[model samples]
Target chain A: MNKIPALSPTVLLAVALLIYPLIFSGAFYLDVGVTFLLAAISASAWNIVGGYAGQVSVGHAMFFGLGAYAPLLCYKLYGWTPMAGIPFGIAASVALAILIGIPTFRLTGHYFSMATIAVAELIRIYFGTWDLVGAAIGLQGPATARGWWDLTFRSELPYYYIFLTVLAVLLSFTYLMERHRFGYYLRAIKVGERAARSLGVPVQQTKIRALVLSAMFTSVAGSLYSVKTGFIDPESGFGILVSVQMVIIAALGGAGRLYGPLIGALILIPLQTATNTWFGGGGTGLTFIVYGGIIVLIARYEPGGIYDLWEQISPRRWRRKHAS
Target chain B: MLLLQVIVGGLLLGAIYALFSSGLTLIWGMMNFINFAHGEFVMLGMYVSLLVVMYLGGGPAAFGFGAAFALFVLGVVVYLSLIRYVLRGPMLAQILSTFGLALLLRYTAFWIFSANFVSLPQTSLSGTINVGGILMPIPQLVAGVIAILLTIGLHLMLTCTTIGSQLLAVSEDRGAAMLMGIKPDRMQALAWGLSAGAAGIAGALMAIAYPWSPSVGETFGLTAFVVVALGGFGSVPGALFAGLIVGLIQALSAFWFGPIYKDIVVYALFVALLWLRPQGLMGKA
Candidate 1:
């Protein structure tokens, strides 16, 4: 057990990302980096509930989609500042997170995941038919690349850095969650809720807080997603595939670890980039087949994910033995 | 006049929905796995039955009632291969594996059947049948009758049969059943096979009555999840009642508030039900 460092490898990873765009000047490289960063942030947020707290939510896109829509809706309907709307997105997402988490948290794994998926579909249906957000016609911006109130951007670089900051905050937060008393409560609940409750852990409160933080983090990422694309739609935000992406990312990177989501995103974005560039128009379905297959393989062999591999190789065991 | 028309049409549609929800609930109760790709099973059954229609000259009436049995075989295939292995794994594992299965089945339908929607040709029975002042479509009535028959048959099998008793015992406690000389694995396999077969029967019935695309089953699958959740997980009777309840609620909500907020009503109902009653209506059982 080597001494747990005050500054983790993740802090180093964040620093690396800050400097990455400067060196990786290629268009393809930039695209991959930005995509991974944004998705990684959202996946990390998902980890708070799905990974750390031991809950699986398929309706995560509700928060993500709401995050995308809130800012866009504010811009379209009320002419609010983009930065200001982010807080509103975070607030709405938090409310939804609590609304969903309070009840569905009672469900263990698949049922809970299924509940989330159903909620996402319900949200999608509402958005598709509702007239408030332009209904099925969808909301389009008056202009693009204007950078007014941070509603649009000239390039993807600013958006990348924005998500990178969110990722750093979340990674640091999750690291602390691993060490805090609440973290243990979450793990215990994940292991067995009855036993955890018997041991005096405030199970419901802990789960809800974890989800609240998760919603806040994911919604911010959604806000960035809309700004990057300068468009908002029901399918893009609340799509079932987006929920699947979080599951795959968390599983791939190794759920419950601080850096697992980022590792998962790094692995997936490159594959997605390759598939997108190679297959072009018709490759979409095949790309998903490959995407889903990766998760199946991970579930079968490396259920713990890439983090487990690193844990096995590192001298942390020796350090622990030495300490004992 | 429109009010009368909507109510009649909605009830007829609700009956069609009941057919899909029954199998979904049965699978949930017996196997403790909600087959996310259940809709695709329904989709494949439709295509298979469609082929039956094409081969036997024309129309579902050619096979008449035997079409449900045809779906039974496909269900057994789905069970023996994919589902049997994934049972009793982690919740995430079970869910994702089935979701993968759903994805595979849906995409396969996309490629094999083309993306085009398919339906049986209209006949005299296809039009609305009038009863007193109320008019209901003939096909929906047929679907309603078949769903009730299947539901009753399932109830008897679950309660009275030797295999059904074994299924109930294993679902309650697999380890204890194995200790008592019952083969838990074999029982699980049978349960899965039976559940998949139900999905097939439901699918065949759906295609016989409702027009279908490769993805149409998805709508029902999502709703079936809501129905199962609301009805209480693993309670077929609860699902039957809940399906009708949700069906009427959705229909009435859509009629009054417009379709825009219809799903919100169902979702709100689910959230409230789960909050107020976590074990579900039958969770106490």
Candidate 2:
């Protein structure tokens, strides 16, 4: 069997995506595509810490919320553009991550996960009551002229391209990290933090660095999400479901792998859109029910996720032939 | 006088927290597995109580006991079917299995009952009693009393009974217990049953005072986690102590700062406490 070049498939996929808007010319399809890209970006960012460092944080919605609200609040209160607020949002998320990580990183496994949830809940409750962020009413982006400065677009085309670009950048970043010494250290920590530390891996520092990177990217996604949606609320911004979705997407695709989150987003976003369309008014949590079932089956049978499944089912002879 | 009332109210609320959390702590101690679906178990208990009252016209005692029995069976079934298998998998699988079960149970309730809130009918446990200048709701008082009694009873059972010794032996060393002719599976199933039964009773007791929907489990689940963590993951008495402390903190903070900030106070304290003592107050180091 002839081995295909690694970059060819990715480039082909990118070309296909670029021409998709031109071919489809429908807002719904563009919306779904953008959503997929956004989910992909978020999940990939999460993979840095969750997949690589082996720290499962359920409170990542806190960074997402911060990324979302910082920009919206600045726009609402200070008459600043969301573009101007993005840096501040990223900085705030990083700072908060440090504060949270300092205490939470001391604990391991489930304890750390629980602590993250608590912190996120605390922030959610605070935002729910704090009037400065409009409390539970949430904040709306100002009605502005269609321009890159404000990040508001009349058509979904620009947002689609922006999301695609962000996804590409993040994917490239993850790809680099995967082959780098930093990535190796993270994997080492994941296998055994104590052993990693004994091997002079600087376990805490490495974990924090991974988490900061994860938080920064997640915040960027959050800012983009809020600006694109033109609204931000505590529930929508920092909802536990949002955190769970990121985890699910990463896990489903194959955590720690370069293309894992993208694959996960592809599968999940379409399913989410379909379920919401079909069962939205029915008040049945069918989407979540399916998600739950998938998580169980994956965890029980194949903790390696879909990527691992793919590897197993792929032709071994082809894989070995392509190793060079 | 106002502070006294707040303190009393907090104690009552804390007792119920302890009651619900004891089961979670027991399961953790027995198997080192956290039940993410524990809140759903309590929610099911609430619905069981509601069903018994609506259909069978049972009083508080009958419905409370009914919830316990029903959820006890559920706990055992879940252990045999879901938990037992997941336990052998990775830590992520163990955590997410119950999480999946939680979503399954919660959404099933949503499908059957819809999203609307429901409350129990006025049973024998109603009204309030005034002591000094403080007015105590009778239902809360009874729930609190029952919660303390159940927690202590569980503690005593673990310390005193032959079955308890066998259960502890299995937890201590499954192979050793097997050599002693103890069935680890049966004992573990019983622990799950007891844990879930306690949650059911807690739900019934809580239903007396609080109107709830299927989503109520989220709040209870988070609270149970906090309580169990605070009390020490595997300690029944520690859960009781932590639950009361949390309830008291919540009540006092809610009174002083406002209702919304109450969670902030509890969680801040919780995080700080965990930071200082990662093993928790009573958990083995």
Q: Of the candidates shown, which would achieve the greatest lDDT relative to the real structure? A: 2
The candidate 1 chain A region of ten consecutive residues with least summed lDDT is A1-10
lDDT of 1 by residue, A14-84 (tens): 67898999999776788788899888988998988888877777678988988888777877887665566
Q: Which residue pairs show collisions in model 2? A: none
Location of the lowest summed lDDT over 10 successive residues in candidate 2 chain B = B88-97
In model 2, how large is the Cα lDDT of residue A73? Answer: 88
Error of 1 at A175 (Å): 1.1
Cα RMSD of all models vs. native, in order, equals 3.3, 2.1
Question: What's the number of clashes in each of the models?
Answer: 7, 0
Residue A179 accuracy (lDDT) in model 1: 85
- What lDDT would each prediction earn against the true structure? 0.74, 0.86
Where model 1 places Cα greater than 4 Å from the true spot, the runs are A1-12, A107-111, A141-151, A309-324, B1-5, B54-87, B122-128, B179-181, B259-262, B282-285
Write candidate 2's Cα lDDT for B141-205 as tens digits.
98889889988998899989998899999999999999999999999999999999999999988
Residue-wise lDDT of candidate 1 within B49-123, one digit each (tens)? 677767765555444434455556656665666566556455555666667667666766765776788886664
